[model samples]
Target: MATQAPVKTISPEEYLAQEELATERHEYIKGEVRLMSGGTPKHNDLSGNLFVAFKLALKKQPYKVYHVDQRLWIPSQQIFTYPDVMVASKPLVMQEGRKDTILNACLVAEVLSPSTKNYDRSEKFQYYRSISGFQEYLLIEQEQIFVEHYVKVEAKKWSLTEYTEIEDVIKLESIDCEIALADVYEDIEQ
Candidate 1:
């Protein structure tokens, strides 16, 4: 019998570089790399609507908004994730001469998919809270009127609020802006 070749696990740096070189997006967690799935029609519509709303609200302000193409790096976890929408107040960090590591993001939003809902609501929410400069995290659901907002109160505490109606507005205290539930779900089929 022929001996099998040993498999190799790529380091975070290698994974990051490879992702940068590739045409498609890939997320790195610890030493594992996984290709990200494309968004559904509903997901895409929701994200586009939210992006427009956020852009309109934050225009002429100091904040900059980024959509899905951007990636955020969590050094603590050695992870790189692409938030559906992100608002950064300060300049982002660069790696491999690319500005992919977003720092000073005051608000991060994720349009929840069935596959990623639990992770986004629980694990990813916890990880985002670990960032010292992160002020708010938003999770929007597609199938229902579910919206979760996590606002950091201080170094050790955070407030949890959930909105499940189209009439509700998500108030982002850090940015002095409010997002209507209807605006977020606009154009989304469900």
Candidate 2:
């Protein structure tokens, strides 16, 4: 029998160091790296709409809103992925020796894509929940005016509310921000 060599997995520190110099974005999970897929127009629009709404709603407040390109690290899960929209109510927590990675986020939003919807809702969400500071999660469907809002009710417990009508409003309890369904799907044709 022939023996095969074991694959080399990079450490989180090594991944962060290389991530800074790499041109394209990649996510790290469990010592392995995965390339992020490109988003569609609807996806971009939804992300932008929510970002603008959150930015406007939380203006002049202590909360900070971050859109794409801001990497979030879940220390407990050792997963590094970029959220479509993120909100921090307190000072931004930076990963030691790195500015691109954050450790604390009260709110995280992801616009669902057909290619990643399953991963986002299951594994990805489980990873996000590992963060002690995560309070609310927004899962938006790009194909329809539907949203699944998950709020942390207690440790390891959550409440889910679904919104389907354009008139529906989602209350982001973590940052005291409210977003109307119409505002969320604005400028995007069905």
Model 1 lDDT at residue 105: 68
TM-score between candidate 1 and the true structure = 0.89
Candidate 2 TM-score, true structure as reference:
0.94
Lowest summed-lDDT stretch of 10 residues in model 1? 90-99
* Candidate of highest TM-score: 2
Model 2 regions more than 4 Å off: 1-8
The superposed Cα distance between candidate 2 and the true structure at residue 19, in angstroms, equals: 1.0
Task: Estimate, for each residue in 114-142, the C-alpha lDDT of model 1 and write its tens digit.
Answer: 88888888888777776667899888888
lDDT of candidates 1 onward, in order: 0.83, 0.91
TM-score each candidate. Answer: 0.89, 0.94
Question: What's the lDDT of the predicted structure labeled candidate 1?
Answer: 0.83
Model 2: per-residue Cα lDDT at residue 22: 88
Residue pairs clashing, model 1: none
Tell me the lDDT of model 2 at 142: 90
